[model samples]
Target: MGGAMKIVLIDSNARAVSSEDREVSVGSLTRLLGSKPAVTARLPNGDRLLTAKEPCVDNGFTIGRSRVVVGAGVVVGKRDAVGAYTPPKTNVDTLTKLVRWVAPDNMPRESEDGRTMVTAILVDPETRDIRQVSLRSDAGSLDGAVGGRCRFMMRVTTADAVFVKVGIGPRAAWRKDGLVFPGRSLIVGCSRYGTLVDVATDIASLRASVEFKSPDAPDWLPPSR
Candidate 1:
């Protein structure tokens, strides 16, 4: 791979941080983590399951550099000339509260007609966990803009499969219109490649990049070297 590939670190939240590099390769992971070692664990049924723990992180390129961990996973072998990691799954939900007026009941609601979308970043909020990113917005107007037509526009992001679940609720009757109902909700699970799960949405295919870290890396691996 070229020098373009950089390392990525994904916190427990699943949000990803792409190391400032390009052309990340798969074989590099095995070298950094040392090959996977076979481990044995007894199951509750008195049976043993053999498993392999792949390395997902590596030391910094040189001494005194920041450590680098692949946000996603490493790209191992190629299938049909395409390098791919274990694809992450995405799940998300969107809720909309429709009100005839702007007040405590409605709270300055945007036009009921715009598209509602969402964007998210995966991050483990626990402080004990090394991964944490501050998501400023708790509850407020989404930054996205709506089209001239009154359609609502919503966007969200997440780590696993990016899934979009539209709002679902009862309808409301407006002045003269009689019964005006909310739009149908949508659940989209897109591959890294941009392919939506059920809906016919264009998504770029996901390419493999990183993997897990070696079990001993926490201790034996230098902080940045």
Candidate 2:
């Protein structure tokens, strides 16, 4: 990848510190955490699961020097990491809200009206999740953007596939008329976890960018390096 990729950090609010970096490769995430995420708990069914709730903060991702420590609730993987992490309950609800807003209320929508089309990032009242926005499929000659907007949920552990209940959602602001007195932007603002605040740059293809060598990466999409 060249100097074409960029990253942005957000706090608890919709405020953001965007990136000017040229390229953010698929093998982009490099952990700066204290250790690999490890948590052990037995399920009520007598099963077990490991938990990594830590968030990606600062160079927690090697995108650049700038990093924000949202929390370590997310798992920290190896150098070439690939796994899924579900959004917190809050984000789950937020996602539900965004999906519901669309007329039919599906998901994985595209941006037809204009800016709200591609979801660069999803923002809650405070903090933002990179993968939590609508994706524009046609923009980069990519897949994933199937509906009017792209939405991914289910929060699988990073594997070969970025799995979710993907579908198209309605771009709420448009209706054969001009702009809705209150125009919408890419950064969606929300109140809780499942909600979203649209950002200016939603790189949907990255959702498909998995570590090239990781067997966990989705086989259909291009591998991330």
Candidate 3:
């Protein structure tokens, strides 16, 4: 069922007298997110919701938690609606960290050859600094060409996020060359704090573009247009 409680609102200052707290609604959630709110919140459940009428999706990533679109903003939790003062489940703030913790076991394996695997995750945000990534294990042979078909035997080389259509299951395995994410990659792995798209799924996919960060980049993703 849909959640209740409208957090977003429209504004007006038509009269001379002041008033008490009133509810407001907005037409679009996208505009609200674009406004770049100062505060973002998460409820008791696993969703990463906001109070000031903002949508959640950004860049090529979605907040791992489920979201309920309220009046203008979104509420992240299990139930559709809850009390206004919903507390968080953990002390670990930040949406990315929340998602990484939300899914403790989302590491993915391929379906084709079933031999390749994803081992690490890293991020390079447009404005944020590139935090050093700690590899949990050795990801063997992430890219190559077999039978003239380019793919990762198992490797991730670039920092650009490879977008995918389906969410991966933890410790899940797929056949080799089976991951077909849109932009030059096909691997996804989960970290202690979140999931990551293996942008360097193969050699050819990375070689397909030249307009990005490095000459050796399998794909190119400038911070922003």
Candidate 4:
């Protein structure tokens, strides 16, 4: 299942290959992931279901959890409509500390279905300045790729090196225009090498160009267009 999430890559012949795990037909995977219902089903005991629900965030990753209690219905599998879900955790101390310090205070407050958004906060430990960097799902909606290709455009790079903690949350809603929600979660740490002197102020714009900050190796993003 994890392999399904690896970014697809092309070989010298331009043929797509799976880098991490089992290879799946790109077309099929795309259809399965793309057309998820606003609500989905989960199988319980003896193909009987006792609940129904939608996806939400725990920690900082997407998860399907129960919203309705039906007592009993049709059991499909052992996986509950509300299964055990947790954000993928990282062991980096710096990131852990920073996220602990900042996330609760700055998590996004909007809620909507089918929305995936990232909010970046850059802190200059040396300078102790905090800048709120946010990107809305609307700003970088994924679309239009051949053969189940997933894509989006956003600007997220800094001119100077900096340590950035990015947190992504899922918004839950019952209607097109309802109260904003805060439940789903996804978090990633980015360290930009060189000098990301202006990263904080330009995060949103950077994401708009699909450019993001990285600290470990050479920048792996496309040049500004």
TM of each candidate vs. truth: 0.17, 0.17, 0.24, 0.19
What is candidate 4's lDDT per residue for 1-225, written digit by digit as tens?
A: 112322222121121222322223334333333322121333231222212132121212111222211111111223235552212222223222222111122223343653333444432222222344444422121111011222221223322222222224422211012222121111122222111111234534532433222333343333233
- lDDT string for model 3 (97-186, tens) is 323221213334343653323433222222211222222222222222011122333333333333222223321121123332222233
Give the lDDT of residue 58 in candidate 2: 23
Stretch of 10 with least lDDT, candidate 4: 139-148
Model 3 misplacement above 4 A: 1-24, 28-31, 34-60, 65-73, 76-96, 99-225
User: What is the model-wide C-alpha lDDT for candidate 3?
Assistant: 0.30
Please name the candidate that would achieve the greatest lDDT relative to the true structure.
3
Between candidates 2 and 4, the one scoring higher on TM-score is: 4
| Superposed Cα deviation of residue 170, candidate 3 (Å) | 23
The per-prediction CA RMSD against the true structure, in angstroms, equals 25.0, 22.5, 17.0, 20.8
For model 1, how does the per-residue alpha-carbon lDDT over 106-136 read when each residue is reduced to its tens digit? Answer: 1111224422223322211111111211211
The better-scoring model by lDDT among 3 and 4 is: 3
Give the runs in model 1 whose Cα sits over 4 Å from its true position: 1-29, 33-73, 76-152, 155-225
Q: Rate the local accuracy (lDDT) of all candidates.
A: 0.23, 0.26, 0.30, 0.25
Q: What is the lDDT of residue 76 in candidate 1?
A: 19
- Model 3 lDDT, residue 149, Cα: 25
| TM-score of candidate 4 to 2 decimals | 0.19
